[model samples]
Target: MALWGGLGQAATVAQLVGADVGGLISNIIQAAATARQNKKECEQLARRVLMIADLLPHLQDPEVMRRPEVRRPLTGIDDTLREAHELVTSCQGKSAAYQFVMAGRLADRFRDVQSRIDSYLLVFPFISHIDITRRLDRIYNILLSNDTAGPSSSAGSQLDVLVSQEVLVHRHGVGKFTLKELVVATNNFAQEIGRGSFGRVHKGVLPDGREVAVKSLGKASSQHGWQGLLRELDVVSCLRHKHIVHLVGCCVVRQKKSLLSFWRKNVEKQEELLLVYEYMKNGSLHDHLHGPSSSSSPSPVMASWKMRIEILLGVSRAIEYLHDYAGVIHRDIKLSNILVDSSWVPRLTDFGVVVNWDEA
Candidate 1:
């Protein structure tokens, strides 16, 4: 059997190796075909370049091609092309093999350098310090074809690995978490600390030992199968702010058992539809402002009128940051989701219900 044939079914293998090889293979093949096509294009370009060199004198006025400065550079290029043409033409037997080998190496090096230049120009005529590395990937085939002369599956595979490496690094920096890491962190969604109309919340700790509150979602009352959860997750994960609750990460995988695991409760398996967060110790403002005093405390640290006013201002500032600065609207702004820290710092929580004005 193939090493990965039934591997997708095994949770361990699926988590470690990922279940995207078929997709990656398809992408690699597509890129290779593109590179092959590009090589043909570059071959055509080579012909054109030769033609342009030959016709330079006739195409341009004598004055343009003859001026000492302008003529010198054209003459230089003409001489270089002449040398290349002679080297290519003079190949007899073994010398021809050597010339072809040298040409391939030179072309490969030129193509690599050309690929870097094209990468810079991707989002360019725009900025010098800017990088649109992913766009460069779209023309991988063309660049490879120009450089390599012909396509090889091995070369495609190599390029696939290279691109994957770069994208993976970028993803890590962008704060992507794998499925297993989320699963173990949330105690398999066992501990339900909070609940609401949209979902149940659970407490978890990250690998770094940071405590986090995870909101495990349920199917929307109107929609089936957690479709709305996904949209919310995507939006929240992209949003970054100091005042708003930081969305650490989320999980979205589709496998028969794994999908079933989320709704089911077996000790051995758990499904994941939870958003990780930085846990707040001092509960919500509703709790502090209204809930009964805790038994452990000698007496609740009741907020004076001044403290109360300060707390209200803190909440207002959080909303202002989201609405005016971040261009987001807290559609469900209320006292319950406004959490307080040990330092009495108020944090805007519960982004699940927030409305993105930009999206609207």
Candidate 2:
């Protein structure tokens, strides 16, 4: 059978209401109750499905439902709910080994369903115009909360689990580095190469004798900074391309310290986030275009029309890859963010603010 079977047909509100949405919702709830693994994710999906079910009544008005905007999102929700039902049901009565093996895939499926449902809710017109706005907001907040908690938290330990277990093992071959290893590699942060809004960059030599540029998140002690670091890691770890900066590995360390109080002594800890990438010997495009020289002129390479065109084409290809294949937008695109290797191949770096196109 086709996935999202009903999506091939034009769906009317009456047909959707009279059809299997209610049945699908009920099945999802029952399946979630018996889920052996990913139970919390299943339950969250069920709640969001029920909330969407409540909005169906508001969408049933003949005039409002006739509009393509309203009908299309409703149809999408219907299809998504069916998928959710199937996903939850599959988790029931499975053997421990089966569940363990499928845990990561199941989690990814749940996250995809939740994201789709959230998107439909945002685009569904009646929710915003009617009395359901507050309910919609609650559902939206629940989705956001689920997204940022547990495996998605900015805490060093949680991020470590996400990067090492989920990302490193499955998607890319990015490794996890220790603080001591990084300190030794960078000579205790001795050679500063560059700096950006998030942190400073340093030149380092890996134990393998490969050169790398290390970006340290200077403000990771604060909540916002930690979140930004998490965002960058999450985006960059999954991407692999010739024109994109390669993520060699990452380091997340929690450093402990003791504090003296008037009454007693206390202990505290802070996390440090760092990303390692292949070193670009030629530096950033901004430096070639604007950095000072004895002759007060741009670099010979930058002054060449042929070289500039080649650089532009390389950058364009990278952006195209990010949009068409990777489904992400590089929100930060600038001369300084684009680095070149000795071969003059441009590498797009900095993804702290990158967002999925759907979310954008």
Where does candidate 1 clash, by residue pair?
A: 35-141, 39-145, 261-271, 262-271
Cα lDDT of all candidates, in order? 0.50, 0.71
lDDT of 1 at 185: 86
Return the TM-score for each candidate structure. Answer: 0.46, 0.51
Clashes of each: 4, 0
The best candidate in terms of lDDT = 2
Which stretches of candidate 2 lie above 4 Å from their native place? 1-164, 219-221, 254-270, 295-298
- Give the lDDT of residue 258 in candidate 2: 11
Residues 224-257, candidate 1, lDDT per residue (tens digit)? 3253454455455555655567776654432222
lDDT of 2 by residue, 1-360 (tens): 121232223234437434466567667777888888778888899777766565555555465555565556556566787899889888787888998998899889989999998887676455445424343344344434543462233443443343234334443347888889999999998999997557789999998899999998774345455556566777788887999999899886644211101112222343576889899999999988878764665575656889889889999999999999999998889999999998988889988778899999
Q: Return the clash pairs for model 2, or none.
A: none
